[model samples]
Target chain A: MPIIEVRNLSKTFVTKDATVQALKEINFEVEEGDIYGIIGMSGAGKSTLVRCLNYLEVPTQGTVIVEGHDLSKLSGAELRSLRSSIGMIFQGFNLLMQSKVIDNVMFPLLIHKVTKAEAKKKAEQLLDTVGLSDKAQAYPAQLSGGQRQRVAIARALAMDPKILLCDEATSALDPQTTQSILQLLKKINRETGITIVIITHQMSVVREICHNVAIVQSGEIVERGLVEDIFTHPQSRAAKQLVIEGKDPDEFAKEQEAKSKAVPILHESRKIRIVFGTQSSFEPVIANMILTVGVPVNILRASTMDVGGTARGDMILGLPADPASQEKIISYLKERGLAVEEVQ
Target chain B: MTANEINMILTGVWQTVYMTLVSTLFGYVLGLPWGIALTVTAKEGLHPNKVVYRILDIAANIMRSVPFLIMLILVMPLTMLIVGKTYGSTATVVPLVISAAPLIARMVESSLNEVDHGVIEAAQSVGATNFQIVTRVLIGEARVSLVSGATITIGTVLGYSAMAGTIGGGGLGDIAIRYGYYRYQADILWTTVILLVLLVQLFQAIGTLISVRMDKRHI
Candidate 1:
């Protein structure tokens, strides 16, 4: 059985002025040890959907079955116990600012009624796993943002949870720090075989650590599959936009506008935009095609990036004015498994 | 000042301290729970109950709106019933506590509210019960702020204790009214006023020291 099966889950938040549907008919299943990513812009209900897995925000409809137990049918005590097995971290690194690092890690263990000595011992071990054993005596405010998040991770792992939920866990940190935290999360997943779920607006984050991904848009899952499939062939408009932008949409639009005025228009030639997945992007397919078919290709606008530790590129190639040569080049690219689309 | 007069002033200081400290303690006894209830019953709270929150919120507002002096006179009957008499330093505590409790409750409620909702959610995610969240997360996280609020409450209660003197409640205020205003002893009036100011400063200093020691944010 899948470790977590969410079926037709929906959530709506009601305020005095209006009722907002935060999640609508969301359906997904998490396998035993998959690093699942829920990717979306802000307000896409990614956080709400993750929270509903642990019942932090109760679903408005449908059921969540974890480990053969329907979460909606469980009693309060059963839910609490289930939650203990499902650990979650936050974007803000919500460590108890008042407590020492050790004590913060000890929080869940203490809540679970573990003896203080045993809790302390277990907390120390978890802190060691996160590589923060020396800073156990320090308060959260005394540490940097990255260190605080490490502490939060330690605290989350204190219960030896079966699943770990990360709600934008590295969003607050700088790029360098985000890389290190993602590495740490990946390491934990590899060593422990714990199922991990990451909710984020940053596609780069999902690309870095997630194996499977679901693209959420306005309270619905628009697309979901292997990270490689989504990155290589984004089927939906939202997924395509995410693949193109690779960051916040607003900022990307602003950046594109700033560069737009300075760039010259394309000349009179056939333009083909090809999206190369990790495997195809690295191979000398373009060079081999040019050498064999003898079609001179002009690169108009090309950008290559690493998505999920694999090289992928969105390249717009200017083909020769001859219709025969353009057709030959398109056929060659398609035969090699590259997703090709004609541009104006 | 003569030695005899200085001893009288010292006695007045003792009485003022006694009334302020005792009343502040009792005030918290009632107000802490009142504040917790206010926080937990509100719309955004852990266990929101509209009717309970509305009633308690309105009651706190009404109690706060009444000036301390007016409240003292208004609660005289209940004060007398509680303490057998409504004059002197010990008896004055009855009315002083009643006035300070509502103010303390409001302060406590605001302090608890300042605790981050994220922290509370973190606790809940770890399978913490509502009681555990309230006691360990809400109260634990807000401890520094609670202490800071308590300091302000202590200072305000000291001022209210002096107001008790107008109704024959013993303290520096009683001495100031009888020995300075009535008898035209300007020296006695100034002496009591200075003593009151010094007492407020002392309480403030001590409260700040304790709050600083308890604060883990800076260190």
Candidate 2:
């Protein structure tokens, strides 16, 4: 069974001027132990949607089922108990700046009335888990952005939550810090087998470690699917755009060849598009083919990028000067499908 | 001035100190809870009861605007019922506290509001109960600012005690009005003013020192 089931959830926030629909009929299920990512631009309601899972925001419509209990129906003490099991982190790292790192990590446990010594021991262990064992005595302001986030992650996990809600948790960090934080999150998901709900605008974030992904825009979910399937065969406009930007060319040509038909694609009139993959390398093969045929070649646009440790490339080419030249280029790229775009 | 007159002035200074200190203590105690209630019932708070917030807000404002001397006279019946006199230090405390409560409460409420909303949200997200958030998160987060508010409230209440002269409360103002102003004793009048200034300086210094000591988080 899915660890979480959200059905047709919507929320409207009323301000002095007008009501804003923050969420609209969102439906999804987070399978147990899956690092589920909800990607969106700011104001896309991804944050609001994640908050609803822990009752941080009450949904105006729909229901949340977690571990066989409907969240909307829980209240007061029962609700508190429910929240204890679902940890949450925020964009700002939200550590109480006034508090020491250890105390901040110990807060949730202290609130549950754990003894001081015990809470301290647990906090220490959690700090070590996030790899900040020595900085427990320092205040949050004294730490670097990465260090602060590590403390926050430790605090969130202090309660041993089955699910962790990361609301743009890496958005405020530097690029290097963001990567480290992502690695830490991935590690937590792997070792502890915790489900993570990551909300972010960076496609690279979803590509990093998330197994399943959902894209939201303007308070509505636009697309969702398994990470590999969506990246390999995007069905949504936004997903396609994301995949294209992250693609690499030589690798892409090879992938296209894998998906190519038995009939040779060599034609004087047709343009060749190359898809890049992670392992695609600098090859003179395409140029060599044109040189061998004594035909002039034209290059349009090309891009190469690696995501999830695999290089992806996409390149568009104009017609070669002759039929044999095009045929030679097609066979050349197709022969290297292991490093180029497979046939699509 | 004669030794007798100087002694009377001494009595007046002591009276002012007595009234100021007692009223400030009462105001501080009363204001803490009222301030907490005001913040909790505010729009974005945990239990945002609009009606209760409005009523408390208006009552505090109306009570705040009333002059202390006038409030002393206004609450005469209630003061007399409680203290059995309308003209003594003990009787004066009732009206002084009544006047200072809302001012202190508002000061504390504003201080609490200065705390980062993120801190409170963080505490709540961790399954903290309302009481835990207030005492542990909200109050703890605003501790330094709250101390500064308390200091100001005490100083304002101390000022109010001097005006309790009209009610025959024997403070420095009572001495100045009854002896200096009535008899045209310029030296005594100047002396009382100097003494009050000194008192205010002392309170302000202590307050700033304590507030600074508690403020570990600059933001």
Docking quality category of candidate 2 according to DockQ thresholds: medium
For model 1, the local distance difference test gives 0.89
Q: By DockQ, who's the top model here?
A: 1
lDDT of 2 by residue, B1-219 (tens): 889888987887788778888887888788788888999999987789999899889999999988877888899999889999888677888998998889888988898888787677777778999999888788877888887887787678778887887558878888878777788999988998999898888988998999887665653
- DockQ metric for all predictions: 0.87, 0.51
Top of the candidates by TM-score: 1
Residue A49 of model 2 has an lDDT of 92
Candidate maximizing lDDT: 1
Across A61-141, the per-residue lDDT of candidate 2 in tens digits comes to: 999997777987877888887777888888888777667899999999999999999999999999999999999998887
Q: Count backbone overlaps in model 1.
A: 0
Give the CAPRI class of candidate 1.
high
